[model samples]
Target: MSLRSLFVDFNSYFASVEQHEDPSLRGRPVGVAPVAAETTSLIAASYEAKAFGVGTGTMVREARRRCPGIQIRVARPERYVVWHHRLMEAIDHAIPVGRVGSIDEVACELVGRQRRREVAEEIAQQVKNEVALAAPGGAIRCSIGIAPNDFLAKTASDMKKPDGLTVIELADLPHALHGLELRDLCGIGPSMEARLHEAGITTVAQLTAADKHRLRHAWGGIEGERMWGLLRGAWLPTAPTERGSIGHSHVLGPELRTPVGARAVLKKLLVKAAMRMRREEMLSGAMAVRIRFIGHDQRWERDLAFDPTDDSRELLRLLNGVLDSGNRRHPLPGPANATPLSVSVTLMRLVPRTQSSGSLFAPTQDTRRVDALVDRINNKFGYNKLYFGSMQLALEHDAAPMRIPFNRVPDTDSENEAGHDPLWLQSLNRFKAIAEGEHRRRERGGKGN
Candidate 1:
């Protein structure tokens, strides 16, 4: 009996979710952009759009030119996350879902006394049915790939798209993988492929047959063997158990040039990074804030140590101080010049809040009070509705993160008042019919007694 794994990958997950929610987008060439604009590129592209050479990271303009009928919608990370959670829950109901790789893809490990093939098909059918029911009136589909290992399962999943199922058995490895490019392997990224080519290893077969010593010389000891094993269908690398860091970075558009404008952008980035860190249930002991100038010649970066905080306000304050000091040291020589590059806020040294160090400066209670007030004002009226004076103009962009999916998250005040649990409700509703049957049985028993 051989071990078998099944990988179920949602097709063009974010774009598919959008299309599923909006039937009008079905069968059309649609692209999701980070922001709603002609300038923004495609963050996700549907299969219909991909047929026209439109893919993730493609500029909207180019996508349109390639497929003149392409429709572009801004990326809604919040809405997408909601659907992602729902889909994962659906899969969990069907089979043991392995760690989620990204917002869209998940691997499920098949177990039990039943045949692996039967289990894979049954689980795939269950997942398909669950998604269809949960996402009403929307078209959401997944492709299932069955293989002896995770690497092959992933490759099999990619073999078919827009509702596909591919199975790669151990015996079929040679033929199935023959003529395939080296880059098709999971770990062989562009950089690795380039290095392999430099070593005269142009194909997977060449890589598999290369001298272990020579390959080790090229790639480090562990990584070299890891690559070789993956090519031969061996799953040695275990899936990561926990998340490492939460960070966000973006290049400042033309409008964000002045010191004030830069600060506005920095605040938005900080709030975004902080919010994600909180959602992940993680806190940072140290943080890094960076800024780059127009020509890429001048750059400034600062790392600050704190008593482990995830509060947006505190993070923004530190970011402002860093920016202030950088500007003072590297004064733009004149007001006419502007920095036209990127800003990033990275939260590092992640630790569970329980393990965080006690703040020497202030009590946690006081900090929570301030965060509550800020969260309240932002949730009630709108994000940045009452911001630290630096972000007046930054709030004007309708595509800003806070404004885009404001309706998705629970309102702070309303949640405090009602105490209703949406997640719990969803869980109960999932098995309502089963519970109803039990209730009927109890009623009959009572009547008979």
Candidate 2:
């Protein structure tokens, strides 16, 4: 078999982007956190910090203890999204991107002479060069891996470091992967590792040795069989899936951890999610809310199933009921006391607007017109200028800002700009068109030829 896939993984993506932009952070231990509080965990860490046992998921205070000089910076999601787009545009010039695994990973399909080991390596080098030239801040490095299939190529990419290139020939098969831990492989998180261990798959070697039947039993599905084949360099095609849910989660900063503040942030996230759902012409059939307390071991969660609708008032009313129930069961503390650390709201069980036949109590034409008018006002004025009254405190404190996720590129015009000028908004809409187009191309060709 020839090398058919090439994978690229950015090193400490969020932290590296921060270091690249700021000269003082270069060559120093740096940790990036969503909230700049000691209680918060680092979302990304520079390679220098990794040497001192400080990395992603390390608490800010713990990181400071591990490396006294470590610098903590708040995450700038907008900058990361901008850099992601710039990097992708540059890499597309080098080779065709087959799929985007996440914000920091990309898989490319190689054909004919490009599949040869030497030629693939050269192309990988070209990609690195392109990134360097494209990045305006500094040299943004990446690790490249080449293998017979996308899975093995992704595995190879994880085996290296910043700017490293590695090749995994088919001849090596499972033996080449024996040295790595189960968690090092893709899709094997802590929970999956425990499940594998229960099935006597404590290591990569044992995992590879397990039969398809055994792995299926362990994984409880065909996903196990896919892993069984991928270990031997077998190619498995993956297709893009339709969106099943829209949600947002935010880690509250120290000052915004109060009960009132938590409610406001959650309200903002829900409204933003609802707007996005309406933009896609979809209605939610169910809503779920989760609130995690700062010091409590137990979290508060509530879920409700309702008639499918995109009416914000209906959704808000349902959400308010859920919150009221939770509050009655367990009273929230005062502003100075322990409160929610993070909150998330998800709108799931969705259906297209065309398929949704409203019930007797569905929102009326007048209500629909009002919602449309509100949407127009926001589009013309600003995203947060005319938000629901409940979200005012959170909005004033700059909580629950819009963020771009891996699966979807959000509207930059709505989030990035302060003024919503018609001409500028049109230009930003064009930029969004390009971004959404790029994301769709990757989605269509996910890990498949």
Candidate 3:
């Protein structure tokens, strides 16, 4: 077998982008959080912060304790999406990008002369150079991994640090991976590790050496057999799975922890999810809402099944009913004293929207016109230009910017255009101005008295 795939994984993606956009943050410990709250957890941490035992999922206060001088930045999803496109173009100059594994990872297929080890290494170097040149101030870096299959290529990419390149050849097979732990592989996590241990496959070597049948039995499915193939440098055919659901979750900031605020967030989430479902031409028959309270193990959840529909107003009504039921079953303490940490809305039991037929008792509201109008306005003016009145409270708050999932890229045509909406630009500028003004105010206040 030869080198067939090249994978590039961005290092400390969000933090690196922050540093790239701002020169002063280049070497400082930076932590990116979804919200500007001390209690929120870091979604990404810089290398400088990592040295002090800070990482994703570490609370902001703990990160500050670990690295006293750490700078915390609220995440800007739009900025990350912009950088993703730039990096992809940079890599495309070296080799046609075969697949975008996620926002922070891309893979290219090596063919013909490119498959040669020397040529592959040269292309990898070119990619690194291009990425540095494309990024603002040359602050972004990536780790490149060349292997016979995408899975192992991704695995090799994680073996090193910023701006590192590693190759896993067929000759290196099972023994070369013997020193690595079970979790070193992409799909193996803590739970998977425990299962592997139960199956007498505690090490990478043991996992690679196990029979496909035994592995399948251990996994209770065919995924183990696929893993067995991937471990041995086999390039398996890709199979696409239908999307099962559309959902969104938001981690509430300190100020928006009340029951009313949580409901507002849930409303916004449902609207977003419904919009996406309509865009994808999918209809959902069931909906569920979940709420997690701060510092509490118990969670509140409720689910309801209804006639399949993609109408946002109808879905909102159903979702509100679910929330009301949940409140009655597990009443929230007063908004003043109790805090809900997060809320999620999920739309499940989906089918093609085209398959949905009109119901005899459908509400009299002109949902189709309302939805079409909302989509048109958002498409022209940017997201959240026209939203439900119920979501007014959470409108100013970040609707928890959507993150691109590992398997897909978001629709970026309008967002990536040169002449994107001026309204969105104005909003961004206003936010920046307010932040800068606050910083200056703090500095002047410190200097006084």
Candidate 4:
């Protein structure tokens, strides 16, 4: 009910960072993308570029047509990660972060009620300054919003951008929400907005005033009530916490086909996912694999429990079985008849290894040593210095497939010089201690209190 949350959004982030350090690009419309491939779309655009209607997912060719003389550059992934790490440290200096949405957005739950707005604004400005200094040749700014909950905070942040500080006080609720479009809110994208318009709810105000029963009927139940409450500046009841899960789903491109090709793609994805889970120091109690055959209009899914582990090879073996189960039970239409459109994997029922049992035969020692060796190689040189065999040709086949990025490793020289609270790494030795303490506490009968 009270405004005790802060949402931080980087301002025209990638392009701003580019322009801030280089005054030459200050007034130019700029776009940052992963690859220069003709098929790749713009990932981030400057405020000047956005004014000309350029946005993420806008095709590079169309963006050029929209704004002639626009500057486009491939993003420096390593530098961006360093900037993100610095910003994260700056934010945590002000408030404990509750959730990190992406490289450019973070949410914080204010511990104390008094001075929430003042603290949030100060933190936002500090972050802007710190990121600009930490990221060389990078100029970045952020807009922040302080409100009662995540939805409102995010909405308030987006209401205005590029150095915006919009606050949504409880008293400003229903009236402030009047003319806002459905898509202006976070979850409702273009498709949902179209559906809402067809249902005769065209504005946020209208949605709030509509009948709950009718809204539920049209919007398919819980989502209707959620939208209504959000528009009224009401907070959803907080749920109990549980172990976090990691999952990813990707639809195959035109080039990927055949059962052999599909299996290879699945193995590659699973390996990457397993490595991420291992880095988090967590294990999965169950796994799920799903396949969608759009051309045949068919879907197949399988889930199974397993001894907790983060072994990539083992996960690949399990993935094979999960897919085989689906195929044996209800075979997908032939590859000729159906395109294997989508493959998804879920590492569900996650729990800390200290709390869950792992496979007795698991190669923990060998994998741990390999992970350490990989870390050493990456820190000394850069990411992908050593990689799984499945991903060796990633760069050759897919120009921009997300691989192990260089900035994933903590900065060693800076950490050594500054002893953990480096101006660059922006982390402290105490954080690791605290994390270990929490892990030990969880091992006991009680979770961290």
Candidate 5:
């Protein structure tokens, strides 16, 4: 067997980007919270913070108890997106990037002489050097793994820590992975571990020893058979995937934890999803709204099917109707009555614009054309500069992250929050002058058409 993959996984990507952007944060214990609130969970923690028993999913209050001096900052996703694209460009210069696993991880295929152990190690070092030089403050770091396949390479990458490199030759085989827990493998979660345990495979050694038929029986399908091959470094094609939905969710601050606030935020999220769907030249046939309350598992939700449409106005109207019908039965409580912690909206059952049939009851041609026009204007000037009035409360609160789909970096124009200088993002933005008076009116509190 020969080496076929080199994987790079950035360490504490969110916190590291914070330190990279701010010179004062270097070599400090840092935690990144979605909001600057104590109850919020930490999304990323620096190595120093991790050493102090503070890490991802550690609540801000608990982090302070563990590391009193930890510098917990609110996440700035727009800046992170900028860094993600820059690193991608820099790494592609060193080696052709194969699969961008996520914003913080990438896999590259090795060919020819590059598959040699020493050559692969040298290439890994080149990636490290390029990232260090390209990053602004040289604060970001990564762990690299060289192995015979993508899954194994990713697994090997997780075996080490910040700035460490590991190689797994095919000769190492199942022995090299025996020490890892069932969950340590890329796709094995608690549920999968339970299923494997039920199948009498209690350990990685047993998992590797099991026949394809037994593993398939345990997995309930061919995925198990596929995993059986993947364990021994078989080159298998990844399953094909397609976009099923477009959506966004946000954890609310104290002030916005109300029924009114949730409605406003959902409106904004739906608009954002609509814009993204249109960008993909797709129409949505369904819409789902969800409201998760504070400290509870119960949720208020609705999923409605609709005629395919990409018009933002039609989507907004559908959202309003859903909420209205639900409210008549069981009214959403206000902040004084009950706390609404978070809200989400999704557009589903998507079909390409070319495939959508004309809706007889839908509005004139300008309905869809106006949405495209508004999107272009916002991209040119700034996000929310000409948005619908329903998003007013959300704009005032100003809370949404661009890390919804991990692999898709923000366009950094209309997809980003306002008040940032997105001039450096010419790839997605072209500054154009819109009609001055109408945009100013929209900003001045007009319910835009």
Candidate 6:
């Protein structure tokens, strides 16, 4: 009926976190990349770097050419995760957080008196103030938006950034969003934009005015109808669907460009995926392996459907079999001549471990125990500390660091060895203290009432 949702989006999340962590990095242009390699692309750029036309997907060389003094830092995913939790705690001080849209965005639901525009704006401001306090030197800032639904709220948050607050009232309707391009809306990427154009919906106004039937036809699915409802300020359900698959992909470094190196990387990836699947208590019914060759259009993929499994050894065996069969059909380029660009492994048709029945092909109980023991040892010591000998070639390479996925947050267990700061632990403690203080204050206020 009123402003039912509030969305908060961090501006240049990774770069901001780096600047916040190091006071010297503040006010300077910074870019975060997966690796320190000159050929790597920046995953995020600070606003100052953005002034020089540097941005995500800009190669490090190009970014340096644009901003001669640009600073490039390797991504610290664990630091980002720590800050995410802290920011969520800060927002929770104002209102209960609803859904975490990503590492840098969160949505909160407003109910009762909180739904009033005045109250909603007050909560937004409080959230901003808390976030500033929680961040180091008050360096982090967020844009907040309040609207009738989560979709519009997210769009409004993006309208203005770097300490912005916007409210999209229902009374404003389609006119309020007319100034934005169709791509400004979430889910409207280049391909979707082309489809919208083919359907005679080239503008936000056209999209807003599109009939549900026409939208469904344009999208070729129910998603179009859902978009139509969202455009009209109707709230849509946010329930998650069952996960379809779990996979990991890696862009090979120069050292891993050979077939032997690529296979080693693939083995590492499958082991990681298998560990994750075991953690989730999920079994995979099928598996797929893909390899992309450098300087050629020859992409090789192999898929195999077998009894459900989460054992790393069994999955690796199956993956090796797939690779063997693929090589027999189409021999890989010579070890010295070929250059592999990337490799990926996907575990498909997942089912709950509890729902899976014993299969003749499944590993024996002793094998399962061995796998569990390895997982425990790795978890206790460090990742890859007890990996299979087949992955020895990739031993020096770091395990692909945990990254936030679209539907869920990844749990990372990073050890604080020499030279590494305990910032994550400190941040966690601060969050807990703030939460406890808030709880006590609420209790006292309740008694007073």
Kindly give the number of clashing pairs for every candidate: 0, 0, 0, 2, 0, 0
What are the lDDT scores of the predictions, listed in order? 0.64, 0.78, 0.77, 0.63, 0.77, 0.78
Clashing pairs in 3: none
Worst 10 residues of 2 by lDDT: 418-427
TM-score of 4: 0.68
- RMSD value for candidate 2: 9.2
Question: Candidate 6 — worst ten consecutive residues by lDDT sum?
Answer: 416-425
Which candidate, 2 or 4, would have the higher lDDT against the true structure? 2
lDDT of 6 by residue, 236-269 (tens): 8587878878776666665666677788888987
Writing each residue's lDDT as its tens digit, candidate 3 over 100-209 gives: 76678888999999999999999999999898789857568999999999998998898898778999999999887898888888878767888888989888878888
Off by more than 4 A, model 3: 326-338, 363-365, 412-449
Model 4: per-residue Cα lDDT over 168-214, one tens digit each:
87888767667677777877766687878889878888876887776
Poorest stretch of ten by lDDT in candidate 4: 415-424
RMSD of each: 14.7, 9.2, 7.8, 11.9, 9.5, 12.0
* Cα distance off (Å), candidate 1, residue 419: 24
What TM-score does each of the candidates earn? 0.74, 0.88, 0.87, 0.68, 0.87, 0.88
Off by over 4 Å in 5: 136-138, 327-330, 333-338, 404-406, 417-449
In TM-score terms, candidate 2 sits at 0.88
> What is the per-residue lDDT of model 5 for residues 100-132, given as tens digits with 9 covering 90 to 100?
776678889999999999899999999999998
RMSD of 1: 14.7
Better of 4 and 6 by TM-score: 6
